[model samples]
Every structure is written in structure tokens, then in C-alpha cells.
Target: MFCFLIDIITYMHSNTFHIIIGPTIVKSIYSGELTYDSDQFFRTGNTNSYYYQAIDIIVNITGNYTVKSNSTIDTFGYLYIYSFNKTKLSINQVTKNDDKSGSLQFTLISALQSGVRYIVIVTTYSPDVRGPFSITVSGPATVGFHVNTAATKPSSSVTTTTRTTTTTTRTTTTTTRTTTTTTRTTTTTSKASTTSTTST
Candidate 1:
């Protein structure tokens, strides 16, 4: 004769996927999921427990979809989800596991929306060292925020030009009287003329 003992924790979300929140052992929990023991701790103290929603999604024709779950100072780490932004979406933080072992999952669901994009960023808090928040995205993909700053306009358009010019005019006159030169009838005359050129 022989006796054996094992444990497993499986959690499911409506309209979403399933996850093993605790130890994943291949055993038949034929004791048949012992009644939810109120005194039973999922892990330990505030450092080791989490709460999750039974339902995973709600969809709107168009808009932003956001989901979030935070962790205690003890169990802060990367946040995980099923898939990101079937439409525009945002994912918040991670919640702790009861035993100082696991983390919580937050889910946001939405239909495809026009002119909108989605992304999920996974970041860590104190005591838990991880890389910069991992980002997941779809449709106009990005690893960062998208606000479409380039599409904005400041004001209407108008053009202007300027021109300047200067002009100068000069006048002069010369008069000669010759009443005495007619008496002699033999007057000799020589006239010298001077010329000047002006440029503009």
C-alpha cells in the first residue's frame, strides 16, 4: 500500500485565459478543492497575497481601455496580461502572491477602434529588481506612449515681402547776350563745353 500528497492552484478569468497562481504540480487534487478556508493564507502576510477579478473584459466600440493591479512593497515586479490592446489600452501594476512567490495579472479587453493604438508597460517597484516596464502593443505598434503630436496645427498661413528705391533729378541753364558783337560784324567766338555723367 502507498500514500501520496500534492498541491496545485489554477485560476480562470471569464472571456480570458487560465493561469497557475501557485505551485504547478501534476497531481489529482481528488480531495476535490478543499473548501475555501478563510484562515488559509495564499502565501504569507501582506508581502505574499493577491486579489484578482473573476471577469477579464469589457469592450466599447471606441475609446481607451485600462486595467491595473498593484503590489505591496515586498512583491513589486513586472506586470503580465493575456494580450494587449486589441484596441487602445493601458495596463497598470502587479499584485503580490500570498507566499512571496507569485504575482497578479490585470486584463483589459476592447474591440478594434479606428485611429487609436494600444500598449502595455511592465515596471518594477522597490525590493524587486526588473528591467524597464516591458511593453506589448498592436496596430500602429510602439514600445511607448502615442499621442500623435505631429498631427496638430498651430495657425493659418500668410506671406509678406518689402522693397525700397531712390531717385534724384538735376537742372541747369546758360544764357548769352551779344548786342555789341553785331557792330563789328567780325566777331570771333570760341566756347568750351564740359560734360559730366551721373550713375544711379
Candidate 2:
């Protein structure tokens, strides 16, 4: 009798599941203009004067952001946290940049946080420069830009009321006149000169 051989077979199966996480990027652009009416500030240790515009930054996500400017004027950028004081040019400053992508534009990279208020100042490298400037901010989420309205003074309005009474036998005459006076101060300065003039 022939011996029977026993054979054993085994089978195995394997499976894998993978998840990839990537960063989210969002871009926002703001178009603004700088004129003689724009806010002015002097850089530290420099007698040169500059006209600037302060923009309030509000973010929805916390991440690194790239803030850039596109303008014909030589642009200078400053990033600040909490508040931005025009007089105190260096206080609370997070970062600053002069030029990065050429065209005399400035690019500033900063780590921004959510729930925190930030300020971005766009200025010129040269003194008394004014023009149109566009800003682009790219981060994890879109951001909101609010121009600092405190730089512009609010106009006040004055109202006057007049009353007149007349009798049957007599007549009354009344004259009402309103006069408005506006006073402005003009100043002239050079790159190396700082002179102010007030006109009354």
C-alpha cells in the first residue's frame, strides 16, 4: 500500500489605509492709495519723512502669512501686533521689509495668530512719496483689511435755529447770517530739511 502525503496550504491578506494632511493657503489683495492727506511718520534715527497708511489685519486662521506690496513707489512695509503708533515707529513692531520681489516692492513674512489684532503699515522708502499701492496677503485663511480711520479727522457740523414773532399793528425785520472759517497749516520739508509753517 502506498503512503498518502498530507499537504498544508496557508493564505494571508494585508490591507493599509493612509491619510495625508496638507496646509491650506488663502490669498487676499487690497488696493489703496497714499496722498498728501495720508498719515505721516518719521523712521527712527532718520530725519527723512514718510507718508504711511495703516491697515488693520483680522485673520480667521493662525498661520504664517506673506504680506507684499505692488506699487510704482519704493515701498516699505512694517508689521505690528496689538497697536501701531505713528509717533513710535519701532514699538510693537513684529517685522519689516524693504524689497523682495523687485520693482521696489516690499515683502514681509510674519507669523500671525487668530483672535489677535494686527496692523500693517505701508510706506515709501523715499521722503514725501505718495502714490497708489496694492497689498497681497497669503496665509491659511483669508484676512480682513480695515483702514485706520483715526488718521482722518472727523468734520463737525453746526446747526443754528432762529425764531421770529410779528404783531398785527407792528412789523419786525430779522437777518440771519452764517459764517464758516477753515484754518490749515502747511509745511515744507526736504530729505535733509525739516521746517514747518503755520498760517493764521
Candidate 3:
């Protein structure tokens, strides 16, 4: 008068998934020196005399990153999106910092995308200054640095443009100073009531 049911199931499938989160490298340190042989560039808003070194930044994950420098020299940092053109100092600039980490060091923060090429430019705040330095990058993944070996300088056209601008600026300043001096002399002469004052 009682009934019993039994069922057996068989399955054939298997899969494995590995997901990695967070930074693979907590901090990556790279040391280098900006010597006389290092590439140089005229930093934006600066004269053409600062020695600089360019490093290619490669990452495996997309996230925010912080780049800091440790050096005895007054350090300046620049972040570029794709490529850096020494002829055009600001063409691909994302951000730049100076002394943000204190003690003449710099700290730069920006969001970086995986598979995208980025360039970090390390230069000095003072012209022709050179010394050894170490840069540390902290981000979502280990950052790879490849030193760019290409020597860079402003293009001929850019050089011509810079010379023209400098000449124009100097001429303008000279004219302005001369005019001011003339005006001041006229005013003094008009105020002078005695012949001796006017003669002097």
C-alpha cells in the first residue's frame, strides 16, 4: 500500500574563474640619474635649459595612480597621455606638479587606463640641474618603466618661433622703459620752479 520514488542525476561540466583585484604591486621603485647625457627640454613656462628624463609607463590595470619622486635635486613631474613631444612641451600633458611631496620632490596623481601608453617626464625646477633620483609609483597594478632613449630638442620651426618671441618681448620692454623714463623727466622739469633745478 506504500509507494517509493528514487531519481539519480549525472552532470559533466566544469569551469574555473580567477579574478584578481587590487594592485599587484603595492609600490614600484625605479632609480635613475639625470646626467649631462640625459635628454633635455624647455619645460613649459621655463627657459630652454632644464635637463629631463622621459620614462614610458605601462600598467596592467586601470585605476588611479600616484607618482612620486625622491631626489636631492628640486624635482618636477609631468604626466602625458599618449606621447610626449619635446618640440611641443604641452601637447599631451595631463598634469604636472612641483614640490607636492615636499623637500623639493614632486607628486603627481592621475587616472591611468590599461593598454594605454603613458609617459612620465622627470625634470628639475632649476635650469641645467642634474642629479640622481628615484621615482615610486603606486596603483592598481605593477607599473613598467622603459627609459626612452631618443634624444629630443625643439624642432627648427619651434626654435625660430621662440627666438622671434624673445626678440619681440625684449623690444617691447625696452620701448616701454624708455617711454616711462621720458615721461618722468618731463614731469620733473614741469615741477621745477628754479633755474638750478631745471638745469640739473
Best by TM-score: 2
Error of 1 at 12 (Å): 50
- Cα lDDT over the full model 1: 0.26
* Candidate 3 local lDDT, 1-200, one digit each (tens): 11223333334422333232322435666778888777777785557788888888887788888999999999999999889998887798999999999999999999999999999999998898988888888865577887884653321110001111111111111112223333333333355465544553
Model 1 agreement with the true structure over 1-200: per-residue lDDT tens digits = 11222223233311222232332111100000111121112222343222111112212233332333333322222222443321222343222222233353233333334443332232223322322111122221111232212222221211122222222222333344456544445778999999999999
How far does residue 186 in candidate 1 sit from its true spot (Å)?
99
| Residue 169 of model 3, lDDT score | 12
Per-prediction CA RMSD (Å): 33.4, 45.9, 36.6
| Ranking 1 against 3 by TM-score, winner | 3
Q: Tens digits of per-residue lDDT for model 2 on 1-200?
A: 11223333333422232323344556788878877787777864475468888888888888898998989889999999999888787789999989886989999898899999999999888888888888888877788888884553232212222223321222233445578999999999767778999999
Every model's TM-score: 0.17, 0.64, 0.62
lDDT of 3 at 65: 85
Scored by lDDT, the top model is 2
Order of models, best lDDT first: 2, 3, 1
The CA lDDT at 60 in model 2 is 80
The per-model lDDT (C-alpha) reads: 0.26, 0.75, 0.73
